[model samples]
Target: MGVPVASGASPLDAHELLRKGEVSRALVLFEKMHDPRRPDPAVLAGLVESRLALGEAHRVAPLMPHLADAALHAPSKDHHTGLAHWALAGLAELEGDHDRAAGHFRSAGEAGPDDPDLLPWRAGLALALTRQGRSPEAVRLAHEHLTRARASGSAYARALALRTLAAVDGASSRRDLLTQALEELEGIQATRLRAQVLTDLAGVLVLLHEDRGPGVIRLLREAELIAVRSRLRPLLDRVRRLLTRLDQPAGSTAPPGLEGLTPSELRVVELAASGLTNREIAGRLVVTVKAVEWHLSNVYRKLGISGRKELPT
Candidate 1:
Protein backbone atom coordinates (compact mmCIF):
# COMPACT_ATOMS: atom_id res chain seq x y z
CA MET A 1 0.00 0.00 0.00
CA GLY A 2 1.20 3.47 -0.86
CA VAL A 3 1.41 6.15 1.82
CA PRO A 4 -1.34 8.70 1.55
CA VAL A 5 -0.68 12.40 1.23
CA ALA A 6 -2.48 14.98 3.35
CA SER A 7 -5.26 17.10 1.96
CA GLY A 8 -4.10 19.79 -0.50
CA ALA A 9 -0.76 18.04 -1.15
CA SER A 10 0.42 18.66 -4.70
CA PRO A 11 2.29 16.44 -7.15
CA LEU A 12 4.88 19.18 -7.35
CA ASP A 13 5.48 18.50 -3.68
CA ALA A 14 6.56 14.98 -4.66
CA HIS A 15 9.02 16.37 -7.15
CA GLU A 16 10.40 18.68 -4.47
CA LEU A 17 10.77 15.73 -2.11
CA LEU A 18 12.78 13.83 -4.72
CA ARG A 19 14.98 16.87 -5.34
CA LYS A 20 15.56 17.23 -1.64
CA GLY A 21 16.72 13.57 -1.41
CA GLU A 22 13.66 12.42 0.47
CA VAL A 23 13.27 9.84 -2.26
CA SER A 24 11.27 7.32 -0.24
CA ARG A 25 8.69 9.95 0.64
CA ALA A 26 8.61 11.11 -2.98
CA LEU A 27 8.11 7.53 -4.12
CA VAL A 28 5.24 7.09 -1.71
CA LEU A 29 3.55 10.22 -2.99
CA PHE A 30 4.02 9.27 -6.65
CA GLU A 31 2.88 5.71 -6.07
CA LYS A 32 -0.08 6.88 -4.07
CA MET A 33 -1.30 8.98 -6.94
CA HIS A 34 -0.37 6.51 -9.67
CA ASP A 35 -3.06 4.67 -11.63
CA PRO A 36 -1.70 1.64 -13.43
CA ARG A 37 -4.51 1.58 -15.99
CA ARG A 38 -3.87 5.12 -17.21
CA PRO A 39 -0.51 6.09 -15.81
CA ASP A 40 0.09 9.78 -15.31
CA PRO A 41 3.22 10.61 -17.30
CA ALA A 42 4.51 13.02 -14.67
CA VAL A 43 3.86 10.54 -11.87
CA LEU A 44 5.33 7.72 -13.92
CA ALA A 45 8.45 9.74 -14.60
CA GLY A 46 8.78 10.59 -10.94
CA LEU A 47 8.15 6.97 -9.97
CA VAL A 48 10.88 5.63 -12.23
CA GLU A 49 13.36 8.35 -11.27
CA SER A 50 12.81 7.77 -7.58
CA ARG A 51 13.12 4.01 -7.89
CA LEU A 52 16.27 4.32 -9.96
CA ALA A 53 17.81 6.56 -7.31
CA LEU A 54 16.93 3.98 -4.68
CA GLY A 55 18.62 1.18 -6.69
CA GLU A 56 15.43 -0.52 -7.77
CA ALA A 57 15.49 -0.03 -11.53
CA HIS A 58 14.01 -3.43 -12.30
CA ARG A 59 10.75 -2.53 -10.59
CA VAL A 60 10.24 0.30 -13.06
CA ALA A 61 11.95 -1.08 -16.18
CA PRO A 62 8.80 -3.00 -17.18
CA LEU A 63 6.88 0.25 -17.17
CA MET A 64 9.28 1.79 -19.68
CA PRO A 65 7.14 0.72 -22.63
CA HIS A 66 4.47 3.11 -21.45
CA LEU A 67 6.99 5.94 -21.42
CA ALA A 68 8.40 4.99 -24.82
CA ASP A 69 5.65 6.97 -26.56
CA ALA A 70 5.31 9.80 -24.08
CA ALA A 71 3.69 12.21 -26.54
CA LEU A 72 0.98 9.71 -27.39
CA HIS A 73 0.57 8.87 -23.75
CA ALA A 74 0.00 12.51 -22.77
CA PRO A 75 -1.38 14.05 -25.93
CA SER A 76 -3.32 16.74 -24.14
CA LYS A 77 -0.41 17.81 -21.93
CA ASP A 78 2.76 18.85 -23.71
CA HIS A 79 4.49 19.62 -20.41
CA HIS A 80 3.77 16.07 -19.27
CA THR A 81 5.49 14.69 -22.35
CA GLY A 82 8.39 17.08 -21.83
CA LEU A 83 8.75 15.94 -18.24
CA ALA A 84 8.79 12.26 -19.23
CA HIS A 85 11.33 12.83 -21.99
CA TRP A 86 13.55 14.83 -19.70
CA ALA A 87 13.51 12.04 -17.11
CA LEU A 88 14.29 9.38 -19.69
CA ALA A 89 17.03 11.51 -21.20
CA GLY A 90 18.70 11.84 -17.82
CA LEU A 91 18.57 8.05 -17.32
CA ALA A 92 20.02 7.42 -20.79
CA GLU A 93 22.84 9.85 -20.16
CA LEU A 94 23.64 8.14 -16.88
CA GLU A 95 23.72 4.80 -18.69
CA GLY A 96 26.17 6.23 -21.26
CA ASP A 97 23.74 6.05 -24.17
CA HIS A 98 24.57 9.46 -25.57
CA ASP A 99 22.60 9.02 -28.80
CA ARG A 100 19.44 8.04 -26.92
CA ALA A 101 19.97 10.85 -24.46
CA ALA A 102 20.33 13.38 -27.25
CA GLY A 103 17.21 12.11 -29.01
CA HIS A 104 15.08 12.17 -25.86
CA PHE A 105 16.32 15.63 -24.91
CA ARG A 106 15.34 16.82 -28.38
CA SER A 107 11.90 15.32 -27.82
CA ALA A 108 11.68 17.28 -24.58
CA GLY A 109 12.49 20.52 -26.40
CA GLU A 110 9.91 19.82 -29.08
CA ALA A 111 7.32 19.26 -26.38
CA GLY A 112 7.94 22.60 -24.73
CA PRO A 113 9.97 24.84 -27.00
CA ASP A 114 9.43 28.02 -24.99
CA ASP A 115 9.57 26.65 -21.42
CA PRO A 116 12.36 28.08 -19.26
CA ASP A 117 12.59 24.68 -17.54
CA LEU A 118 13.92 23.31 -20.82
CA LEU A 119 17.17 25.27 -20.53
CA PRO A 120 18.86 22.67 -18.32
CA TRP A 121 17.53 19.91 -20.56
CA ARG A 122 19.21 21.65 -23.53
CA ALA A 123 22.44 21.74 -21.50
CA GLY A 124 22.06 18.00 -21.01
CA LEU A 125 21.71 17.52 -24.78
CA ALA A 126 24.90 19.53 -25.22
CA LEU A 127 26.76 17.12 -22.93
CA ALA A 128 25.30 14.13 -24.75
CA LEU A 129 26.43 15.55 -28.10
CA THR A 130 29.89 16.19 -26.66
CA ARG A 131 30.16 12.51 -25.74
CA GLN A 132 29.07 11.51 -29.26
CA GLY A 133 32.11 13.31 -30.76
CA ARG A 134 30.16 16.38 -31.83
CA SER A 135 31.90 18.98 -29.68
CA PRO A 136 31.19 21.85 -32.05
CA GLU A 137 27.46 21.23 -31.93
CA ALA A 138 27.68 20.76 -28.19
CA VAL A 139 29.51 24.05 -27.75
CA ARG A 140 27.03 25.90 -29.96
CA LEU A 141 24.05 24.43 -28.13
CA ALA A 142 25.53 25.19 -24.72
CA HIS A 143 26.34 28.75 -25.71
CA GLU A 144 22.79 29.30 -26.91
CA HIS A 145 21.45 27.95 -23.63
CA LEU A 146 23.86 30.12 -21.71
CA THR A 147 22.53 33.20 -23.48
CA ARG A 148 18.98 32.22 -22.59
CA ALA A 149 20.02 31.38 -19.04
CA ARG A 150 21.52 34.83 -18.64
CA ALA A 151 18.45 36.50 -20.13
CA SER A 152 16.22 34.59 -17.75
CA GLY A 153 18.26 35.95 -14.81
CA SER A 154 18.16 32.72 -12.84
CA ALA A 155 21.62 32.23 -11.40
CA TYR A 156 21.03 28.50 -10.86
CA ALA A 157 20.14 27.94 -14.50
CA ARG A 158 22.95 30.23 -15.64
CA ALA A 159 25.44 28.29 -13.53
CA LEU A 160 24.36 24.99 -15.08
CA ALA A 161 24.55 26.42 -18.60
CA LEU A 162 28.00 27.87 -17.87
CA ARG A 163 29.10 24.44 -16.61
CA THR A 164 27.92 22.86 -19.88
CA LEU A 165 29.91 25.41 -21.92
CA ALA A 166 32.94 24.80 -19.73
CA ALA A 167 32.65 21.07 -20.38
CA VAL A 168 32.89 21.63 -24.15
CA ASP A 169 35.53 24.35 -24.18
CA GLY A 170 39.34 24.09 -24.23
CA ALA A 171 41.20 23.59 -20.94
CA SER A 172 42.05 27.27 -20.38
CA SER A 173 38.60 28.50 -21.32
CA ARG A 174 37.14 25.63 -19.35
CA ARG A 175 38.78 26.91 -16.19
CA ASP A 176 37.43 30.42 -16.70
CA LEU A 177 33.90 29.25 -17.45
CA LEU A 178 33.84 26.84 -14.50
CA THR A 179 35.11 29.56 -12.19
CA GLN A 180 32.32 31.82 -13.37
CA ALA A 181 29.87 28.99 -12.73
CA LEU A 182 31.15 28.54 -9.20
CA GLU A 183 30.70 32.27 -8.63
CA GLU A 184 27.07 31.96 -9.62
CA LEU A 185 26.54 28.86 -7.46
CA GLU A 186 27.47 30.58 -4.24
CA GLY A 187 24.76 30.34 -1.53
CA ILE A 188 22.65 28.07 -3.76
CA GLN A 189 21.28 24.65 -2.82
CA ALA A 190 22.78 23.13 -5.93
CA THR A 191 25.13 20.75 -4.17
CA ARG A 192 25.27 18.23 -7.01
CA LEU A 193 25.95 20.93 -9.54
CA ARG A 194 28.66 22.43 -7.41
CA ALA A 195 30.29 19.03 -6.92
CA GLN A 196 30.22 18.37 -10.68
CA VAL A 197 31.87 21.68 -11.47
CA LEU A 198 34.46 21.06 -8.79
CA THR A 199 35.25 17.68 -10.28
CA ASP A 200 35.62 19.18 -13.77
CA LEU A 201 37.73 22.03 -12.44
CA ALA A 202 39.97 19.58 -10.63
CA GLY A 203 40.48 17.55 -13.81
CA VAL A 204 41.32 20.69 -15.80
CA LEU A 205 43.73 21.86 -13.15
CA VAL A 206 45.46 18.48 -13.11
CA LEU A 207 45.78 18.52 -16.92
CA LEU A 208 47.20 22.04 -16.88
CA HIS A 209 49.73 21.12 -14.18
CA GLU A 210 50.94 17.74 -15.32
CA ASP A 211 54.23 18.31 -13.54
CA ARG A 212 52.46 18.41 -10.18
CA GLY A 213 51.07 15.40 -8.31
CA PRO A 214 47.51 15.62 -6.97
CA GLY A 215 47.65 19.32 -6.22
CA VAL A 216 43.94 19.65 -6.77
CA ILE A 217 42.99 16.82 -4.43
CA ARG A 218 41.33 19.38 -2.21
CA LEU A 219 38.79 20.20 -4.89
CA LEU A 220 38.10 16.54 -5.68
CA ARG A 221 37.91 15.71 -1.98
CA GLU A 222 35.24 18.32 -1.44
CA ALA A 223 33.31 16.88 -4.37
CA GLU A 224 33.69 13.42 -2.93
CA LEU A 225 32.29 14.63 0.37
CA ILE A 226 29.29 16.23 -1.26
CA ALA A 227 28.54 13.20 -3.48
CA VAL A 228 28.74 10.90 -0.49
CA ARG A 229 26.49 13.08 1.64
CA SER A 230 23.97 13.43 -1.16
CA ARG A 231 23.94 9.66 -1.87
CA LEU A 232 24.93 10.30 -5.47
CA ARG A 233 26.16 6.79 -6.10
CA PRO A 234 27.42 7.31 -9.65
CA LEU A 235 29.22 10.54 -8.89
CA LEU A 236 30.49 9.15 -5.63
CA ASP A 237 31.95 6.14 -7.40
CA ARG A 238 33.57 8.39 -10.00
CA VAL A 239 34.98 10.67 -7.35
CA ARG A 240 36.38 7.70 -5.43
CA ARG A 241 38.16 6.43 -8.53
CA LEU A 242 39.55 9.84 -9.33
CA LEU A 243 40.65 10.21 -5.76
CA THR A 244 42.45 6.87 -6.01
CA ARG A 245 44.13 7.98 -9.24
CA LEU A 246 45.37 11.22 -7.73
CA ASP A 247 46.60 9.65 -4.54
CA GLN A 248 48.48 6.73 -6.06
CA PRO A 249 51.71 6.68 -8.03
CA ALA A 250 51.44 6.47 -11.83
CA GLY A 251 52.05 2.71 -11.98
CA SER A 252 50.44 1.76 -8.67
CA THR A 253 46.81 1.72 -9.79
CA ALA A 254 45.06 -0.57 -12.25
CA PRO A 255 45.57 -0.10 -16.01
CA PRO A 256 43.83 2.93 -17.47
CA GLY A 257 41.07 0.79 -18.95
CA LEU A 258 40.42 -1.06 -15.69
CA GLU A 259 40.57 2.19 -13.77
CA GLY A 260 37.91 3.73 -15.96
CA LEU A 261 35.37 0.96 -15.39
CA THR A 262 32.66 2.06 -12.97
CA PRO A 263 31.88 -0.33 -10.13
CA SER A 264 28.62 -1.29 -11.88
CA GLU A 265 30.40 -1.93 -15.18
CA LEU A 266 33.08 -3.92 -13.41
CA ARG A 267 30.41 -6.11 -11.84
CA VAL A 268 28.79 -6.68 -15.23
CA VAL A 269 32.11 -7.56 -16.81
CA GLU A 270 32.89 -9.96 -14.01
CA LEU A 271 29.58 -11.76 -14.39
CA ALA A 272 29.91 -11.93 -18.18
CA ALA A 273 33.42 -13.30 -17.80
CA SER A 274 32.05 -15.91 -15.38
CA GLY A 275 29.97 -17.29 -18.26
CA LEU A 276 26.69 -15.60 -17.42
CA THR A 277 24.56 -14.49 -20.33
CA ASN A 278 23.16 -10.98 -20.34
CA ARG A 279 19.68 -12.19 -19.43
CA GLU A 280 21.03 -14.25 -16.56
CA ILE A 281 23.05 -11.34 -15.35
CA ALA A 282 20.04 -9.02 -15.51
CA GLY A 283 17.99 -11.44 -13.45
CA ARG A 284 20.82 -11.91 -11.00
CA LEU A 285 21.40 -8.20 -10.58
CA VAL A 286 17.72 -7.23 -10.47
CA VAL A 287 18.19 -4.84 -13.36
CA THR A 288 16.89 -4.86 -16.92
CA VAL A 289 18.51 -6.72 -19.84
CA LYS A 290 18.99 -3.31 -21.42
CA ALA A 291 20.79 -2.11 -18.31
CA VAL A 292 23.10 -5.12 -18.42
CA GLU A 293 23.82 -4.35 -22.08
CA TRP A 294 24.51 -0.72 -21.27
CA HIS A 295 26.99 -1.75 -18.60
CA LEU A 296 28.72 -4.12 -21.04
CA SER A 297 28.90 -1.38 -23.62
CA ASN A 298 30.61 0.94 -21.17
CA VAL A 299 32.92 -1.88 -20.11
CA TYR A 300 33.84 -2.62 -23.71
CA ARG A 301 34.56 1.02 -24.45
CA LYS A 302 36.69 1.48 -21.34
CA LEU A 303 38.58 -1.76 -21.94
CA GLY A 304 38.96 -1.21 -25.70
CA ILE A 305 37.52 -4.64 -26.35
CA SER A 306 35.38 -5.80 -29.28
CA GLY A 307 32.63 -7.74 -27.49
CA ARG A 308 31.78 -10.47 -24.98
CA LYS A 309 34.56 -12.71 -26.33
CA GLU A 310 37.18 -10.16 -25.37
CA LEU A 311 36.09 -9.93 -21.76
CA PRO A 312 38.48 -11.66 -19.34
CA THR A 313 37.30 -14.85 -17.67
Candidate 2:
Protein backbone atom coordinates (compact mmCIF):
# COMPACT_ATOMS: atom_id res chain seq x y z
CA MET A 1 0.00 0.00 0.00
CA GLY A 2 1.47 3.30 -1.09
CA VAL A 3 0.29 6.81 -0.74
CA PRO A 4 1.22 9.38 -3.37
CA VAL A 5 4.50 11.16 -2.63
CA ALA A 6 3.48 14.54 -1.31
CA SER A 7 4.33 17.54 -3.43
CA GLY A 8 7.84 18.84 -2.73
CA ALA A 9 8.52 16.11 -0.18
CA SER A 10 12.08 15.17 -0.96
CA PRO A 11 13.59 11.85 0.00
CA LEU A 12 16.66 13.76 1.12
CA ASP A 13 14.50 15.43 3.73
CA ALA A 14 13.32 12.02 4.90
CA HIS A 15 16.92 10.88 5.28
CA GLU A 16 17.69 14.10 7.09
CA LEU A 17 14.83 13.50 9.45
CA LEU A 18 16.44 10.20 10.35
CA ARG A 19 19.76 11.95 10.85
CA LYS A 20 18.05 14.42 13.13
CA GLY A 21 16.23 11.67 15.05
CA GLU A 22 12.86 12.82 13.75
CA VAL A 23 12.01 9.29 12.75
CA SER A 24 8.25 9.60 13.03
CA ARG A 25 8.19 12.25 10.33
CA ALA A 26 10.70 10.35 8.22
CA LEU A 27 8.49 7.30 8.34
CA VAL A 28 5.53 9.29 7.04
CA LEU A 29 7.41 10.51 3.98
CA PHE A 30 8.91 7.10 3.27
CA GLU A 31 5.52 5.49 3.50
CA LYS A 32 4.02 8.06 1.13
CA MET A 33 6.79 7.42 -1.37
CA HIS A 34 6.81 3.61 -1.24
CA ASP A 35 5.04 1.74 -4.03
CA PRO A 36 4.86 -2.00 -3.68
CA ARG A 37 4.54 -2.68 -7.40
CA ARG A 38 7.65 -0.66 -8.22
CA PRO A 39 9.20 -0.18 -4.84
CA ASP A 40 11.93 2.37 -4.20
CA PRO A 41 14.86 0.81 -2.40
CA ALA A 42 15.74 3.98 -0.56
CA VAL A 43 12.20 4.35 0.62
CA LEU A 44 12.08 0.74 1.72
CA ALA A 45 15.34 1.07 3.59
CA GLY A 46 14.24 4.27 5.28
CA LEU A 47 10.91 2.77 6.18
CA VAL A 48 12.52 -0.18 7.90
CA GLU A 49 15.03 1.95 9.80
CA SER A 50 12.46 4.53 10.88
CA ARG A 51 9.99 1.93 12.05
CA LEU A 52 12.60 0.10 14.09
CA ALA A 53 13.98 3.30 15.59
CA LEU A 54 10.57 4.17 16.92
CA GLY A 55 10.23 0.66 18.43
CA GLU A 56 7.61 -0.31 15.92
CA ALA A 57 8.94 -3.78 15.24
CA HIS A 58 5.46 -5.15 14.87
CA ARG A 59 4.91 -2.70 12.03
CA VAL A 60 8.15 -3.69 10.33
CA ALA A 61 7.53 -7.41 10.77
CA PRO A 62 4.62 -7.38 8.36
CA LEU A 63 6.56 -5.17 5.96
CA MET A 64 9.66 -7.38 5.92
CA PRO A 65 8.68 -8.72 2.53
CA HIS A 66 9.20 -5.28 1.02
CA LEU A 67 12.88 -5.20 2.02
CA ALA A 68 13.93 -7.68 -0.66
CA ASP A 69 12.88 -5.16 -3.26
CA ALA A 70 15.79 -3.02 -2.15
CA ALA A 71 18.10 -5.15 -4.25
CA LEU A 72 15.89 -4.79 -7.27
CA HIS A 73 16.20 -1.01 -7.32
CA ALA A 74 19.20 0.90 -8.60
CA PRO A 75 21.89 1.54 -6.05
CA SER A 76 21.73 5.09 -4.91
CA LYS A 77 24.53 6.99 -3.21
CA ASP A 78 22.81 5.86 -0.04
CA HIS A 79 23.46 2.21 -0.98
CA HIS A 80 19.85 1.28 -0.34
CA THR A 81 20.47 -2.47 -0.53
CA GLY A 82 23.27 -2.43 2.02
CA LEU A 83 21.13 -0.31 4.29
CA ALA A 84 18.33 -2.82 3.97
CA HIS A 85 20.58 -5.53 5.36
CA TRP A 86 22.00 -3.20 7.97
CA ALA A 87 18.54 -2.27 9.14
CA LEU A 88 17.59 -5.93 9.14
CA ALA A 89 20.62 -6.67 11.30
CA GLY A 90 19.37 -4.06 13.77
CA LEU A 91 15.95 -5.65 13.78
CA ALA A 92 17.48 -9.04 14.53
CA GLU A 93 19.58 -7.55 17.29
CA LEU A 94 16.42 -6.12 18.84
CA GLU A 95 14.85 -9.56 18.69
CA GLY A 96 17.85 -10.97 20.64
CA ASP A 97 19.12 -13.04 17.72
CA HIS A 98 22.73 -11.94 17.71
CA ASP A 99 23.79 -14.87 15.48
CA ARG A 100 21.33 -13.74 12.83
CA ALA A 101 22.29 -10.12 13.27
CA ALA A 102 25.97 -10.96 12.75
CA GLY A 103 25.25 -12.69 9.47
CA HIS A 104 23.24 -9.75 8.10
CA PHE A 105 25.86 -7.24 9.20
CA ARG A 106 28.48 -9.17 7.18
CA SER A 107 26.19 -9.31 4.18
CA ALA A 108 25.65 -5.55 4.54
CA GLY A 109 29.28 -5.00 3.56
CA GLU A 110 29.17 -7.26 0.52
CA ALA A 111 26.09 -5.57 -0.93
CA GLY A 112 27.88 -2.52 -2.33
CA PRO A 113 28.91 1.04 -1.64
CA ASP A 114 27.53 3.39 1.04
CA ASP A 115 30.60 1.79 2.65
CA PRO A 116 28.90 1.08 5.95
CA ASP A 117 31.18 -1.91 6.46
CA LEU A 118 34.22 0.30 6.79
CA LEU A 119 32.38 2.82 8.92
CA PRO A 120 30.07 1.01 11.32
CA TRP A 121 28.91 -2.53 10.45
CA ARG A 122 32.16 -4.03 11.66
CA ALA A 123 31.46 -2.50 15.05
CA GLY A 124 27.94 -3.91 14.91
CA LEU A 125 29.31 -7.34 14.05
CA ALA A 126 31.80 -7.14 16.89
CA LEU A 127 29.00 -6.36 19.35
CA ALA A 128 26.99 -9.28 18.03
CA LEU A 129 29.97 -11.55 18.53
CA THR A 130 30.53 -10.28 22.05
CA ARG A 131 26.95 -11.12 22.93
CA GLN A 132 27.69 -14.70 21.88
CA GLY A 133 30.77 -14.93 24.19
CA ARG A 134 33.32 -14.34 21.43
CA SER A 135 34.99 -11.53 23.34
CA PRO A 136 38.53 -11.89 22.00
CA GLU A 137 37.58 -11.40 18.38
CA ALA A 138 34.98 -8.80 19.29
CA VAL A 139 37.56 -6.65 21.01
CA ARG A 140 40.05 -7.00 18.19
CA LEU A 141 37.46 -6.21 15.53
CA ALA A 142 36.06 -3.17 17.37
CA HIS A 143 39.51 -1.66 17.91
CA GLU A 144 40.38 -2.21 14.28
CA HIS A 145 37.10 -0.65 13.27
CA LEU A 146 37.81 2.43 15.38
CA THR A 147 41.27 2.75 13.86
CA ARG A 148 39.82 2.59 10.39
CA ALA A 149 37.13 5.09 11.28
CA ARG A 150 39.79 7.50 12.49
CA ALA A 151 41.80 7.04 9.32
CA SER A 152 38.73 7.67 7.23
CA GLY A 153 38.28 11.09 8.81
CA SER A 154 34.55 10.92 9.32
CA ALA A 155 33.64 12.12 12.81
CA TYR A 156 30.27 10.40 12.69
CA ALA A 157 31.88 7.10 11.74
CA ARG A 158 34.47 7.55 14.43
CA ALA A 159 31.77 8.22 16.98
CA LEU A 160 29.84 5.11 15.94
CA ALA A 161 32.99 3.02 16.09
CA LEU A 162 33.93 4.40 19.50
CA ARG A 163 30.44 3.76 20.90
CA THR A 164 30.58 0.10 19.91
CA LEU A 165 34.12 -0.19 21.17
CA ALA A 166 32.95 1.18 24.48
CA ALA A 167 30.39 -1.62 24.67
CA VAL A 168 32.78 -4.49 23.82
CA ASP A 169 35.78 -3.30 25.79
CA GLY A 170 35.98 -4.59 29.39
CA ALA A 171 38.28 -1.90 30.85
CA SER A 172 38.37 1.66 32.08
CA SER A 173 39.42 2.50 28.55
CA ARG A 174 35.72 2.81 27.74
CA ARG A 175 35.24 6.15 29.47
CA ASP A 176 37.87 7.75 27.27
CA LEU A 177 36.38 6.16 24.19
CA LEU A 178 32.90 7.28 25.21
CA THR A 179 34.20 10.77 25.95
CA GLN A 180 35.78 10.94 22.50
CA ALA A 181 32.53 9.73 20.98
CA LEU A 182 30.55 12.48 22.67
CA GLU A 183 33.01 15.04 21.36
CA GLU A 184 32.89 13.70 17.80
CA LEU A 185 29.11 13.54 17.89
CA GLU A 186 28.88 17.09 19.13
CA GLY A 187 29.42 18.39 15.63
CA ILE A 188 26.88 16.07 14.08
CA GLN A 189 23.10 16.44 14.29
CA ALA A 190 22.44 12.74 14.35
CA THR A 191 20.12 13.02 17.32
CA ARG A 192 19.19 9.36 17.77
CA LEU A 193 22.80 8.25 17.54
CA ARG A 194 23.88 10.98 19.90
CA ALA A 195 21.26 9.99 22.43
CA GLN A 196 22.57 6.43 22.48
CA VAL A 197 26.17 7.61 22.90
CA LEU A 198 25.14 9.92 25.71
CA THR A 199 23.40 7.03 27.44
CA ASP A 200 26.53 4.87 27.16
CA LEU A 201 28.77 7.61 28.47
CA ALA A 202 26.42 8.14 31.40
CA GLY A 203 26.40 4.39 32.16
CA VAL A 204 30.20 4.38 32.45
CA LEU A 205 30.10 7.35 34.77
CA VAL A 206 27.45 5.74 36.98
CA LEU A 207 28.98 2.28 37.53
CA LEU A 208 32.58 3.38 37.97
CA HIS A 209 32.13 6.07 40.63
CA GLU A 210 28.68 6.00 42.14
CA ASP A 211 29.51 9.01 44.25
CA ARG A 212 30.06 11.05 41.11
CA GLY A 213 27.55 9.25 38.89
CA PRO A 214 24.42 11.22 39.75
CA GLY A 215 26.27 14.46 39.23
CA VAL A 216 26.31 13.63 35.52
CA ILE A 217 22.62 12.81 35.55
CA ARG A 218 22.39 15.53 32.94
CA LEU A 219 23.64 13.14 30.24
CA LEU A 220 21.01 10.46 30.73
CA ARG A 221 18.40 13.12 31.33
CA GLU A 222 19.33 14.79 28.08
CA ALA A 223 19.07 11.51 26.25
CA GLU A 224 15.67 10.89 27.75
CA LEU A 225 14.58 14.35 26.70
CA ILE A 226 15.66 13.69 23.12
CA ALA A 227 13.85 10.37 23.02
CA VAL A 228 10.70 11.91 24.38
CA ARG A 229 10.81 14.89 22.05
CA SER A 230 11.28 12.68 19.03
CA ARG A 231 8.68 10.14 20.15
CA LEU A 232 11.41 7.55 20.11
CA ARG A 233 9.55 4.94 22.12
CA PRO A 234 12.25 2.28 21.96
CA LEU A 235 14.95 4.64 23.07
CA LEU A 236 12.80 5.93 25.90
CA ASP A 237 12.09 2.38 27.03
CA ARG A 238 15.80 1.57 27.00
CA VAL A 239 16.65 4.63 29.09
CA ARG A 240 13.99 3.85 31.67
CA ARG A 241 15.00 0.19 31.77
CA LEU A 242 18.62 1.16 32.41
CA LEU A 243 17.59 3.45 35.26
CA THR A 244 15.48 0.71 36.78
CA ARG A 245 18.30 -1.78 36.58
CA LEU A 246 20.87 0.54 38.15
CA ASP A 247 18.68 1.97 40.91
CA GLN A 248 19.16 0.59 44.43
CA PRO A 249 16.20 -0.02 46.72
CA ALA A 250 15.74 2.21 49.77
CA GLY A 251 18.00 1.38 52.78
CA SER A 252 20.01 -1.22 50.86
CA THR A 253 23.68 -0.60 51.52
CA ALA A 254 25.82 -1.50 48.51
CA PRO A 255 29.57 -1.99 48.89
CA PRO A 256 31.66 1.11 48.34
CA GLY A 257 32.00 1.98 44.62
CA LEU A 258 29.17 -0.46 43.88
CA GLU A 259 26.30 1.75 44.99
CA GLY A 260 24.22 1.16 41.87
CA LEU A 261 24.29 -2.63 42.20
CA THR A 262 21.38 -4.49 43.87
CA PRO A 263 21.63 -7.23 46.46
CA SER A 264 21.17 -9.83 43.72
CA GLU A 265 23.94 -8.26 41.69
CA LEU A 266 26.16 -8.24 44.79
CA ARG A 267 25.49 -11.93 45.30
CA VAL A 268 26.44 -12.63 41.71
CA VAL A 269 29.67 -10.70 42.19
CA GLU A 270 30.56 -12.66 45.30
CA LEU A 271 30.04 -15.99 43.59
CA ALA A 272 32.00 -14.85 40.54
CA ALA A 273 34.98 -13.60 42.61
CA SER A 274 35.35 -17.11 44.04
CA GLY A 275 36.89 -18.34 40.77
CA LEU A 276 33.71 -19.98 39.51
CA THR A 277 32.75 -19.97 35.85
CA ASN A 278 29.65 -18.00 34.87
CA ARG A 279 27.92 -21.31 34.28
CA GLU A 280 29.00 -22.61 37.68
CA ILE A 281 27.79 -19.49 39.37
CA ALA A 282 24.51 -19.54 37.49
CA GLY A 283 23.89 -23.09 38.67
CA ARG A 284 24.65 -22.19 42.27
CA LEU A 285 22.50 -19.08 42.15
CA VAL A 286 19.70 -20.80 40.21
CA VAL A 287 19.86 -18.12 37.56
CA THR A 288 20.81 -18.10 33.89
CA VAL A 289 24.36 -17.56 32.63
CA LYS A 290 23.21 -14.37 30.95
CA ALA A 291 22.12 -13.01 34.33
CA VAL A 292 25.57 -13.76 35.71
CA GLU A 293 27.19 -12.20 32.66
CA TRP A 294 25.04 -9.10 32.99
CA HIS A 295 26.13 -8.61 36.61
CA LEU A 296 29.77 -9.25 35.73
CA SER A 297 29.54 -6.81 32.83
CA ASN A 298 28.48 -4.07 35.23
CA VAL A 299 31.42 -4.96 37.50
CA TYR A 300 33.87 -5.00 34.59
CA ARG A 301 32.76 -1.54 33.49
CA LYS A 302 33.54 -0.23 36.93
CA LEU A 303 36.63 -2.27 37.86
CA GLY A 304 38.51 -2.43 34.55
CA ILE A 305 38.35 -6.23 34.49
CA SER A 306 37.07 -8.87 32.11
CA GLY A 307 35.31 -12.03 33.27
CA ARG A 308 35.76 -14.16 36.38
CA LYS A 309 39.45 -14.61 35.67
CA GLU A 310 40.06 -10.94 36.43
CA LEU A 311 38.06 -10.98 39.68
CA PRO A 312 39.89 -11.34 42.99
CA THR A 313 39.88 -14.83 44.51
> What lDDT would each prediction earn against the true structure?
0.71, 0.71
Instruction: Kindly report which residue pairs in candidate 2 clash with one another.
Output: none
- After superposition on all C-alphas, the RMSD of every candidate to the true structure, in Å, is 12.0, 17.4
Residues 1-313, candidate 2, lDDT per residue (tens digit)? 1112345776667877777666755776776677888766667778888878766677777656666556435463346666777777877898899998998777776675534323267888999999999998999988888888888877778888889889998963888888888899886777888999888877777678742346456676677777755557777776766666557222223434555666676666655553456886687568999998888888777777765566532
Clashing pairs in 1: none
- Off by more than 4 A, model 2: 1-6, 9-12, 69-78, 114-119, 210-213, 244-313
Tens digits of lDDT, candidate 1, 147-210? 8899987777788888888887554388889889989989766666788888888877777774
The parts of candidate 1 lying over 4 Å away from their true place are 1-8, 17-28, 50-60, 94-96, 210-215, 248-313
**Could you give me the TM-score of model 2 versus the true structure?**
0.69
Alpha-carbon TM-score of each model against the true structure: 0.68, 0.69
